[model samples]
Target: MSALTIYKREVSSYFAQPTAYAIIVIFLLIVMSLTFTFGGFIPAGDASLASQFFAWHPWVFMFLAPAVGMKLWTDEQRNGTLELLGTFPLSTRSAIIGKFLAAATVWFAALLLTFPIVITVNYLGDPDNGTIISGYLGSFLVCCTFLAITMLVSACTRDQVVCLIVSVAVCFVMVVGGFDPVTTVLSRSVSEGLAEAATAAFVWDHFSTLTRGLFRLQDLIWFGSIIVVCLLGTSAILSAKRS
Candidate 1:
């Protein structure tokens, strides 16, 4: 419906310039380089592409996905078009969904651009293709999660730079909140259960669960819920702005 219309327009705008394409290329190059250097694909002696490829996705998307989504609404407001967009027949939620999908599609295209990594893994060893596929799925979900968070931040500001900084800060917190240092501090000051709960609430925990090819319904639910919540938050913010 109207969401589709906005989705089409958003997607078109991304490709109208070389920005999306350049981002995809740079993303692939950086991640792939990190895989070989930091991930130790060959030195680790792992048959699966786990550490080599998928391990860096969460960190990569932390910045890249925000870059993709930061301008979704900020640009509209900056150019004095958000009000015009609001007057359209489309619902606010629909517009939010459309913009989210558009940003998600750009990330999907980025994932596809790295097909050669899959091919390389195949050539190097008889890897578990099923696990590899699941990793891709998990990475996509994480990318969309970043986009949704970015959209929420973007909706609150017309300054794209502010949107980008705030998005990155939020994302960095979500990433580190699950790491040992944060959890360790939480455990010392708080109950162990509270520490565990805090760690579980972070995006990295859910993302790691899915990336390991553990398709738990709960992990999927966690990611899906984050996406929905962020989209609703964006819509609510935009509605207030419109009024």
Candidate 2:
């Protein structure tokens, strides 16, 4: 039928399963607790929410995002529903876009559930709403990028566990590319340009900028490009299967 119909169906499928709710609840609890405890939101003597919220994103997404996205296509393929989906009247591109948007919506809901932290920050001290907004934007973009990567990997296999593991491995490298420990080691052995390029390829560098309330066009482009490339690759794979 229509793209919206597919989108609704996919979104409904996720909500119908208790696993999605469990994942969201568990992820939120872990992130919120870590942000308050390790990130020093309360003990750092600073009212800024940056440390508490943004600090945990890379690590949290390392597992949670992939867990959410691992089933996108893999489950369909496992159930032999993907081929049936192909027989529908909608174009492959529309189906892909619809499914992607549905997954993004689930992620958006997970992000939205963290608003209590936003409220707590606002209540405690003068935090910049602008910066918090930008942080959310950047975090959501990173989630989209991770989800797109997971979707691509999910499309490649019928086993959700395999999809999850592959997605996690891919996402881990991207996250580590921006980590200080990894970058420092790289800078020692490689040129500064190579090190910087590695950092630039991941979500950390761009996300850090956004968390600081600076929304650079290049950062936006980097995240957007990754999503586009992954989704296109996924579409190509599916199209080949149809042929």
Candidate 3:
């Protein structure tokens, strides 16, 4: 089978269930609630959503993205389909990429549904459209990063609940490792240098730059590196298991 065939199957499987719709609705509710309430979008009188709407994406995706991806491999293993998948006329890498793209597509649809917020921001004030686009791109990347991390974890186990817990824990670290509160606490308990290193490793450090419309090359590289590494790791683990 071609990668396209696998991709189509995965995509069909996602929309066939209520899982995709539920995730999309939950994501919208969480993001919208945070933007209006805790984010103070109205009181701040900001036209841009970078600080409010988009800023919450990493935290939200840390949990939700894993939920969406936890089944990618875990389900296959749980249902004894991994061996069936192995018999297909496709490379493990093709299956991996196909499945990853399918999960990414689900998040893409979810992100698109958030356009009402964009409309609201435009109605309230004149916002920089370029910055807003950057924010969306950043949000999507963060979600993809979490999804990739979850994919890696899912490959290691058949239990979906175990996969979800470990994935969320890893994503949580990525989201908060560089957070001001986290870094401040780390600095006191360890060498300032170690704390700085932790901050550098944080997904936040890379993701926040894009939300601000500062497309630094290094930030892009960092995100790309993480996603690629996790996917490659997943492929390696699956290959070993199949052999």
lDDT of 2 at 219: 96
Q: What root-mean-square deviation over C-alphas does model 2 reach?
A: 1.2
RMSD of each: 1.4, 1.2, 1.2
**Cα-based lDDT at residue 118, candidate 1:** 85
- How many clashes show up in model 3? 0
lDDT per prediction? 0.87, 0.86, 0.91
- Can you write out model 1's per-residue Cα lDDT over 153-213, one digit (the tens) per residue? 9999999999999999898888888877788998999879988997789877777766677
Instruction: Give the per-residue lDDT of model 3 (tens digit) for 1-243.
Output: 577888899999999999999999999999999999999989999887888888899999999999999999999999999888899778888899999999999999999999998998898899999999998888898889999999999999999999999999999999888887888888998879978888789988777788888898887888889999999999999999867
lDDT of 3: 0.91
Q: Candidate 1, TM-score vs. the true structure?
A: 0.95
Q: For candidate 2, write residues 1-243 as lDDT tens digits.
A: 587988999899889988669878987898888987888888776655667778788788888888988988888888988878888777877888888899898878988999998888778888889999998898899889999999999889889999999999999998988888888888998878888888888778988889889989999999989999999999998777667
RMSD versus native structure for model 3: 1.2
Error of 3 at 20 (Å): 0.3
lDDT of 2: 0.86
